[model samples]
Target: MGTSGDLPDGFGPTIGTLGEDPLVAGVIERYPSAPWLTVGPGDDAAVLDLSGSRAGALIACTDTIVEGQDFRRDWSTARDIGIKVAAQNFADVAAMGGRPHTLLVSLTTPADVPASWAHELADGLAAECSRAGAVVAGGDVSAGTEIVIVGTALGSLATPSAVLRSGARPGDVVAVTPGSGRSAAGWALLRAGLVSSAFEGLLSEHRAPVPPYPAGVEAALAGATAMIDTSDGLVRDALRIATASSAVLGSSVVLDLDPGALAASDDLLRAASALGVDAAAAAEWVLTGGEDHCLLACFPSPAVVPAAFRVIGSVLAGDSGVGVRLGGKPFDGEGGFRHWS
Candidate 1:
């Protein structure tokens, strides 16, 4: 909030229309130190000292959100954007069965934008960090045509081991968090301008995904063989685990799922019904439609699946590609989301 006199010549005097240094300084003044933070917000690089913890390894993930492409300002406020970005970045750490610790953010926006919007964005980031037991360690800001936010989350494994993508084997049970596809269905509703009070839950899910953070750690503790977050769609992410783990054993993996399982979420079905999307189209959204960030894990056995997860399918010996099966037969339809497609 102060002048940028201490900053270099190129930095602006006001926080609203500033160069990188003053913007960084503004962020520093707003956040305080946490117990685990050794150096925060004001150095060549922010530092977090995790040496005191028993974590044998660190998990890190980074993600970016672009205006118009990833989100619309009309659909999401500054705060919602901040929280959504944080949720996505931290969800990666959780997918690896880690406890999120800190986030480094980078923001770029038009010079004319109000400074208050930036503050709200930061507040949203902080709120999500608090929810995930993490902190805003540091970040940078710059000028751009549209709002762009990039967040990197550093986390520590709850246990010495990580629930990696390369752990599943033949006969492993495929499990997922409850209520998949609501975000995708919600997205459809938003596009159709059918957003009403009846679809509020789905709408919220699309805007701000609340991935089960603890479920990743719980899966790790329950001896989960492999895990992935469904940011890229359920089948696509499942294929990642299958592909990675299958390569280790030199055997192909198949994910056998029931369409009913994907359609099981009440909100998803309700939203689908409201829009008359029908059973087949809803199944496609469940399989595809990225950004849900739900955890999909493979347990050694169905019985070992933790309380937070529901067994939707099983891992089987097959070809390298992920095969979706319904009623013991190959299900026919396109599978999952593609970034460049």
Candidate 2:
């Protein structure tokens, strides 16, 4: 699409006129140097010197979010989009019990789009990177039909090594960080057109997730057996750990939840009630809702979990499968966001 037939269709300004360096420069201006980075964003390549950092190994992961697929431009601002991509990327590094130090952002957008969108997006990415104690290293920008944001995070693991999902044992306790379902609840409200002052937090959560970055390292130090980011949903990711740990398919792990805990989120419950969604269905957001990016780890029985981690359930010695149970009964409803129904 375009302003006219001859002109390229874009958001704010055309990419052809400004070219790549200026846009790259805009990004470079926003991100400062981190201690671990030898060379920052402006160079031909970003170099990281972790020799003094004392990391045993390097951890890296890449993730992408596309327009219409992962998010709606109308619903999310450039800053929100930036925070989301950065936070989720950090979540993956954290899942491995590593501390993120740098990020490489790859962006694709239509030529006709405004340059400000790109700048704002960079600002958003930089902001989140700083929050995680990381910096934007370098990345690629290209023209595409839709807005696409991809972020790759680099981190280091200390003495115990990267925590794998397969480490969970049958007797381990399942634990998770705080704040679970606000994003799902917010999504429900957005879909239902129920936006209001009452739903601000939920709505914000959906736009930009805040994962517990330090908890990953904390969990590892505290002896977490297995770890994963519940970006996919609790049941699904739990199943990943269960299968990786070689638990039987029918009854390997049970993600037990407390009734009091479920009821504790007054705003989420209230949002559900306002939308006429029952308690069970609302609770489904907590169990199956994806994108909150919270850490779920398994610790040994009598696990001395870190201060931020809360024990929710336990791995069971039984058949194969992951179960989400509340009050000891199997939870009924859908779990998490799936790309395809």
Top candidate by lDDT: 2
Query: What's the count of clashing pairs in each model shown?
Result: 0, 20
> 83-166, model 2: which lDDT tens digit per residue?
999999999999999988889999999887677778878888989988998889899898889988899999888545789988
lDDT against the true structure, per candidate, is 0.80, 0.81
lDDT of 2: 0.81
Per-residue lDDT of model 1, residues 11-97, tens digit only: 433445565565666656766468878788877787777778634588888999988778887787778888899999999999999
TM-score: model 2 vs. ground truth: 0.89
Compute the lDDT for candidate 1.
0.80
Query: Where does model 1 exceed 4 Å of error?
Result: 1-22, 29-32, 319-326, 331-335
Model 1 residue 84 lDDT score: 92
Native-structure RMSD, model 1: 5.0
